[model samples]
Structures are given as structure tokens and as C-alpha cells.
Target: MEGNESLSSAMQERGLTQVELAEAVNTRLICAGHEGTVSDRTIRNWLTGKSQWPHPKQREALEAVFGCMAEELGFSPPARRQRPATEPESPVERRNFLTATTGTAASAVPFVGAPPQVGTSDVLRLRSGLDALMELDDTRGGHEGLERAALSGAAEALDKQKLGATQRIRLRLFSIAADYTATAAWSALDARQADRAQALLGRALYLARMAQDPVAEMRVWNSYAMLAHQRGALTEAIDSGLAAQATGITKRDPMFASLAHARTAIGHSNLGDRQAALRSLGHAREALGKVDRDQPRPSWMAFYGPAELTAMTAIVRDRIGDAAEAEAASHKALGAIPKQFRRNRALATTRLALAQLHQRDIDQACSTASNGFELMTGAPIPGRMRSLLGDFYRDLITLAPDAGAAREWGDRYRAEWSRA
Candidate 1:
């Protein structure tokens, strides 16, 4: 029997382990007044094609859990009553059909010898891959492997887009490609590979425009703003932030608008426009306050909630010479940030250290900065975080060239830096 790629893809998209899926199915089954007998082995069987058709009640529970038909999850009926695979339904049609028969379920047989077709299933599969990569980035930050993997995903989407499909599906594939390329660009940017990041963002923006996806386009422009800032093109950075603000998604999603405003604030602060920077920061906070926290957002944007916005505020405050306010913002960000976001926490720790250093709390700054190394002990520090540490080191030495704490902090970081 052929493996059930569709079901596997769906599970991956939901970030479900075999045990989790089984538990979910059992929960639904219990809610439907049926025995909760499904186990991890059952899910494994389904994935490995050891079970082509599950019990009828189990099928119903699966449908309820996934909000789609069993056939779409790659299950097939008995061979004696097998049916041909039909053309994939449009998203609207498929949703409507599924909703019309919510509690009922049936299975269909697949064609063993047919070549794989590019459709919604492929889209789901690619999206699952993207989700996994994004999670990896959250924990480890950016690396060469991540950049290459992201480019590979973009290439896969581009290749799939060349195949026969509806306009909607074609656009989705192009959008996926843009998202993947943008991820690659961000990875390179985090690694301080400015030239490589610039080239990738250019391609991502073109693909985003081709896909007519304002959210993806906004993401590209946000990255463009960051890349410009890294290259010391502060004016271009501000313009790019404005370009992000101009995207349609920013109008529709307050969270996106807030992020755009925050980016602009950074640019303005660095360019010595203290009044404009604070004004933009206020706008960012106001916009963020209007966002509906319960609304579902794409995985790529999982990083930009209150904690991230607060961190951005610290950046603005620090740039504009408000060390006390910057220190308070960094503390708030650290408290609000989730523990799973190791990279963000480490970066925030660096920011806290910077703020302390600026205030001449040399001993306290070293202590806070040491926490960054502890937090990211198992992983190589991202270049961006390393650069931040470098800044702190330079400032510390300049302020206290002969201090005992300065010598010890310098010696400690030198060892860490060489290892990194």
C-alpha cells in the first residue's frame, strides 16, 4: 500500500505527534458518545498505510479534527469498491461540501500507478515544511543550513507552480515561494550576510508582487528595512518601513501596522530624529493595542506580539539616549517573552546589558550579559546577537578600561567568541 502523504502533511501542519493525534481523535470520539479507543499505534498504522480504512466512527472523528474529508487525508476504501480520484475541489467548494456533511464520513480508493499531481495536498505539504523550518528558526536563530533549506522550499514551490492548477492554487504556490525566499533572506540577515540577504529579498518581493499577496509583500518590505539599517542606509531603511506601512495588510491587520511603525521608529531614532522616533513608537503602541489577540496569524508572524514590540521599544529608547526607559522596556520584554523563544530571550538579554552599560552599571551589565551566554549555551550565537555583545564589550572597555570587572568580562567573552 502507498504511504498516506496527505494525512502526514496535515499532521505536520498542526505540529501533532502520533500520540497527540490519537488523543485528539479519541477526544472527539468521546464527545460524540463513542468509546475513546484510538491509540498512537492507530495513528502509526494510518500513516504507514497498514490501515487503508479506519472504523466509521474513527473516520468521522478524523474529519472533525481536520475539518476535511478522509480521502483528502489520503485514506482509501476496500479494493472491491474502489473509485477513481477526481479533480481537486476549489477551496470554497471544498469547505462548503465539508461543512454540509459535517458528521458523516466515507473513504475513497487511490490509483496506485498514477503520478503525483500538484494540488491543495501539495500546498499543505509545502506549508508544513515551512512551519517546521520556522519553529527551528525560533529555537536556534539563523544558520547556513536554515538559509539553504528555505531556498530549497522556495525552489520546490516554484517548480510545483509550473504544473497545471487553478489560478488560486497557482497564486498560493507563488506566495509560498515568496514566503520561503523571504525566510532565506531573514536567515542571511541574522547571520550578517548583507549582500546575500539583499539579493534574496529582491527576489522575494518580486514573487510576492506576482502572487499579489499584501501580507507577503509587507514581510519583504520589513526585511528590506532591516537590511538597509544593517547596511547603515538609515534613510533607505525609513523609506522601506514606509513601504511596508503602505501594504494592504497593514491596513487590515493592526499587528502588521504596529510592526511597520516600530521599524520606522528604529530608523528615525538611528537617524537622530528623536521626536519622530518617539512619535512613531507611540503610533506603534497604539496600533498594537487595537489588535485582536485571539485572531489567528501565520506562523511566520508568531514572533511579533507584545513581547517583540516591547523589545523594539527598547531599541528605539536606547537609540534616542533614554537609557532608563530602554532598560525598563527590555525588562518588560524579557518578562513577556515566552521561554521557548531562546533566540529572542538571548537578544533581549543583550539589550538589557547594553542599557545597563550605558548607565555605567558595569558590574550589573556584565551579570545580565552573562545570562545571554547561559541561555544560548547549546547553540552557536547568531551573528546579530554576537554583534550586540561586541557593542557592549566595546562600550564597556571605553568606559572602564582599567576596571577589574571589565577585564574579567572581556576575558570571558573572548573565550566564548573564539568558540562561536
Candidate 2:
């Protein structure tokens, strides 16, 4: 059956064994209020064509577990009775049509031939190129043109088969490819293309697994958390963040663990669990303290440091309504971040404005937001920045509906973001 082949292909791409797939499916089923768990034997039967089709509940569980549609998972729904010839298309049908077409186009990239025999020099060049792309993303917030170029470069590198390369060299290439893919996924998320981001992240996770690099895997999982959080899937965000922490703990990497914990804290805060949020924040701080200065850090993690931590702290504090502490943290974050990271500076400034608003400093908040909004006009702003600014705008309108400064700031934001 086509179902068996599709399932097998999905398992291979995700680096999952049949047993692992069974476990994952069962976990999803339990979460979906199903009564029983499937065994590895059952999964084997399904993948070997012994079982041609799953029951409706099982099919749903499988689709949910894999983040795919029924047809993508090789399931054909039962035939429907004939409908009116002029029936109107539903929103769901339109979304499905777009998803299928886009997914097909994205997967149709042509394979490149084998790469030339490479040495450390080639690896170094690739790393440098990736660093440049990352710097652009940090400054300009993921321009679509730049993202496409970066993705193409990384995809070409990954497509090349290097048979003569040493095991160490091959692993390094895999790690580099994974890093690029993860960065591309982040760019997609910044551009508000969630489906594309998820697809890229799945590939990144597979590449990381091939490299056997726990640090890279942790980073990819953290990216998944960020994407989920952006999409308002708080439970998924929490789960992904915890997974990142688990990987980081296995690798004994305090910096990675700290970032994961900080993300988890934000998830908890968003869920209104203040105590859990505070506990996670404390864990994040403790982990950050344990990062050794003598050890070399991963290049992908260069953007993370005290400034990023402070920004996260501000976000959690704001979520929990700790206006005073949030304002202080936001100021600290802004001071600690360098001027080169203009996007981060803008985001921090927005948070600072939000904190000021919470404290009833309407004039100061309007002034801070105006400056931040001006900075955002220099580039194609990230979705996260726009979302934060939206929150600030809503709060300002609610709190100071008649203020001229608030009205001016709102007008400016509308004009700037409309172009964005």
C-alpha cells in the first residue's frame, strides 16, 4: 500500500525506527483521548502492508503525530456523496490546496552532483559564508531574497556526496549544513512563513541527528519552540523547549540549557503559571552561571549571552505583570546588547516601552515606542517585533485612548508596518 511506503519514508527522514514511530503515535493518541497504545508489531504490520488502512482515530493520531495531512500520510478518506456542482469552497479547503501546492513546489528542488574532494579550508569557507548570512538576518531581520539565497547555498552543500572525505570532515559538513538549515528555518519564521519554517526545521533536525551533535539538535529544538510560540501553540512550545533542555543536559552544555529553560519560562508565563515561570527563570540563571569561559562556544550560539537572557527575563516578567521588574530588566537588556544587533535593540526598546506603559508612564512609553518604531523602518521587520509592537499599540490605545502622542505613534506604526 502507498501508506506503508509513505510511512517508511517519513520514519527515515525523521531518523525514527519503527519502534520509535509506534511510541510516538501512541503518545499522540493518548494525548488525543484515545484509550489504547499500539505496539511495534502493529506499526510493522502497517508499514509492511499487512494492515492496509488504519481506523479513523488511528489515522487522525498518525496525522497529528507527524504534523501532516491525511493524504500526506497516505490515507484516503471515504468517498463523499455527490454535492452541488456550484458548491462554494470552504476556507479549510483553500488552505489545504495552498499547502499541497506549496509543499510540492518546495520538495521539487533538483539534486546537485557530488562535491569535489574537500578539506578543512572548504569547511572554513562554508562556515564563513553561513556566518555572513546569520549576521544579515540579525541586522535586517530575514529579508526574503537573502533567505532564499542562504537556503540555496546550504541545500547545494548538503546535496553533494563526498565519498573520499574522512569521517571527521563528513561530520563537520553535516553539522554545518544543519546549522544553515536551522538558520533558514529561523528566517522563515521571522518572515511569518510557519509551514516552510517547520519543513526546514524537520530537515535540520535530521541533519543534526546524522552529525550526532547534541548541541545542534538542542539548537534546532529551541528553534522549533520559538516557531511554536510564535504560532500560539504554547503546549508545543513548552514540549519542544523541554526537549532542548534534555539534549543540552545530556551534552552538559550550560549555555544551550540556559536558552531552553528561558524559553520554557516564557511558555509558562504565557500560560499564566507564574510560579512555574519563576522556577524556570531560576533554572535558566543557574545554567547560565555554569557556562565555562575557557571552553570554545559554538558559532550558532554567538548571539546568546547576558543581553539575550535579560531580554527573556523582561518578557517573562511582562507576561506575569511584574511591571517594575520588567522595566528594569528591559533597560539592562538594552544596555548590554551591542549596537550592531539593531533588530535586538529594536525589540528590547519595544519591550521597554511596554514596561513603561504598564507602569502608567504614558509619555515615556510613547517616546520609547516612537524611537523603536523608527529603528524598525530601516529593515523588513521580523514577525516577532511586529507582534510586540502590536501588543504595545493595543495597550496604549486601551490605557490612553485620547493622548496625542499615542495617536501619533499609532499612525506612524501603521504607516511603517504597512510597507513592511
Give the TM-scores of the predictions, in the order they appear.
0.73, 0.71
RMSD per candidate (Å) reads: 10.9, 17.0
What overall lDDT goes with each candidate model?
Answer: 0.84, 0.75
| lDDT: worst 10-residue window of model 2 | 91-100
Q: Tens digit of lDDT per residue, candidate 2, span 1-420?
A: 444688788878878777667655554344334643677898887788777567766665565455565456554444563334454342122111112112221222233786347678767766766665666666667544445445654654565434457788888889888887888788788777889899999999999999888877998899898899888899999999899988944357788888999999999998989999999999999888988867776666777888999999999999899989999999999989988788889989999999999998999998998888777664457777888889999999999999988888888889878646
* Cα-based lDDT at residue 314, candidate 2: 98
- Which candidate leads the pack in TM-score? 1
lDDT of 2: 0.75
Tens digit per residue, CA lDDT, model 1, 166-214: 7999999999999989998999999889999999999999999999999
Find the candidate with the highest lDDT and give its number. 1
